[model samples]
Target: MVDKGGSDTVFRTEERFRQALPDPASMAGWTPRSANAEIEEAPEPAANCGPDADWYCARIARGEANFEAVGEEAQFDLTAFADRSAAQDACRKEKTWSAKYTEAQVPPVPGVDSHAYYRNAGGLDGLNLFMCTGTVVAQVLLEGEGSSLDPATAHSLAQLFASRIHKAAAAQ
Candidate 1:
């Protein structure tokens, strides 16, 4: 497990096999090379046509989809909603969803598990950006996890990480 205390970004793993957790900084495609890394902003392809479409368009127009800085010290704010209604609204606006586990039993965890899974949802070529996140860990699977890692697998990992982090935080 790796914990960035001040940033509150914790990555954990739990398996009966008992392997060491990989370093988050060393994770492939997780770290940015430099402070001057180029930021890219692109429109979401699944265009919505409704009253709220304009609101969504305005958000993208303001470069909300631009890539942010990435580094060991970089902090990615994972905001939590006080209620489901707020969360749903945010999901609708951001085009994201809570990571589902249809293939297996739900794993116990703290906070909320969410994801943005699309076969081809972003960019012109429809690049697949599948990611799953909990309060403790976030995994961005650049290529969709074919059949190797399903939603259940992602959720279970997130749950274990979140549970461990919660326990640690409470102990302090």
Candidate 2:
């Protein structure tokens, strides 16, 4: 889950180990009677996911233990983007690109109407996605030490961060 407070934020998840399941299609002498015969059912939620449990407990109960949150607040300087030219210059210096949007983007946040995306042009490492809601500009940074994440993963991380920021802003 994503957690943002002050200038510190993190998207993280606990590690989990699961046994590999046998592939249904590879099972010997097994065949479906009809294409519609096999109906997939949603897994049941864990017992501790009720309202009485803590947020972590709920997440764990929902089988989201393996999920990882992939952004941090302090990694991106939102104020840097106040001046578009300067931001672009910084991006250039860092071998990155700034993607500004005149229209709304996907992975929508509740309070954000528009946002900017920044990432390494070579797709190595480092990424920032920020949104302005009222006077608050929420920014999320994705830069893992010695690890490079794909654009889709970075966007997902930004979405998670933005959602948290929007929720907190709405509460205030």
**What's the CA error at residue 140 for candidate 1, in Å?**
5.1
Can you write out model 1's per-residue Cα lDDT over 120-170, one digit (the tens) per residue? 323311122221222222222322213243445445444443443344434
Error of 1 at 44 (Å): 20
Q: For each candidate, what TM-score against the reference?
A: 0.29, 0.33
Clashing pairs in 1: none
Best candidate per TM-score, number? 2
For all predictions, the C-alpha RMSD in Å is: 12.4, 18.3
Clashing pairs in 2: 11-69
Against the true structure, candidate 2 reaches a TM-score of 0.33
What's the TM for model 1? 0.29
